[model samples]
Target: AFFITYTYPRTAVSFSEAMDWTPGQLSGNFLLPSILEPGQTYNVRARLETLEDPTQETDTDWGVITIPEAPPEVPPAADIRNLDFGAAGGTYEIGER
Candidate 1:
């Protein structure tokens, strides 16, 4: 028998389930959640155990890295050509002009 385990580094939640495998099945597939935290990595893998004894089990290496969320795009700042004293004039002083 085998199962899948998903670990969340930021949260205490753990999702696990038994795989639907046949007596001679060699391949399997799993679908994970679509949305994950940005700049974070989650752990996911499989585990196998003997039907006769559950204690005799092994864990496979983590084989997937969830796609990271892209950072927000920011526009470039505008350059200030000169200091302009608005209509409210109060003896404005320009420096290094």
Candidate 2:
């Protein structure tokens, strides 16, 4: 099983669900939580479970992981040109427009 921890503001979460596995099963997939934000680093580690011997050391060394920051927002293009609004002829006032 794997665990995830965020240092600042103090949050900890489990990465995988409990499963029944056959002997000799080696690898499996894990899904990351959607609540994780970009530009923040997280700590991860794996733990072993033993059915036969419960007293063994189960935890691995902590590893660092991070998601890259999201891209910047694009600014809109200058659509309207320098037209003279002083030449007002319509019924609408200058403040109304």
TM-score of each: 0.29, 0.33
lDDT of 2 by residue, 2-97 (tens): 766633332333333464443432344344666666666666665554534546434444542333444344578866786556654679555853
Q: Supply the global lDDT for candidate 2.
A: 0.49
Q: Mark the 10 consecutive residues where model 1 has the least summed lDDT.
A: 8-17
TM-score of 2: 0.33
- Candidate 1 lDDT tens digits, 1-97: 5544555432222224464443432343344554544666556554455544557654454553333344444566866786665687488678787
lDDT of each: 0.48, 0.49
Candidate 2 Cα deviation (angstroms), residue 18 = 26
Candidate 1: misplaced stretches above 4 Å? 1-25, 37-41, 64-97
Number of the predicted model whose TM-score against the real structure is largest? 2
Q: Which regions in candidate 2 have their CA more than 4 angstroms from the true location?
A: 1-26, 64-97
Backbone atom clashes (below 3 Å) for every candidate: 0, 0
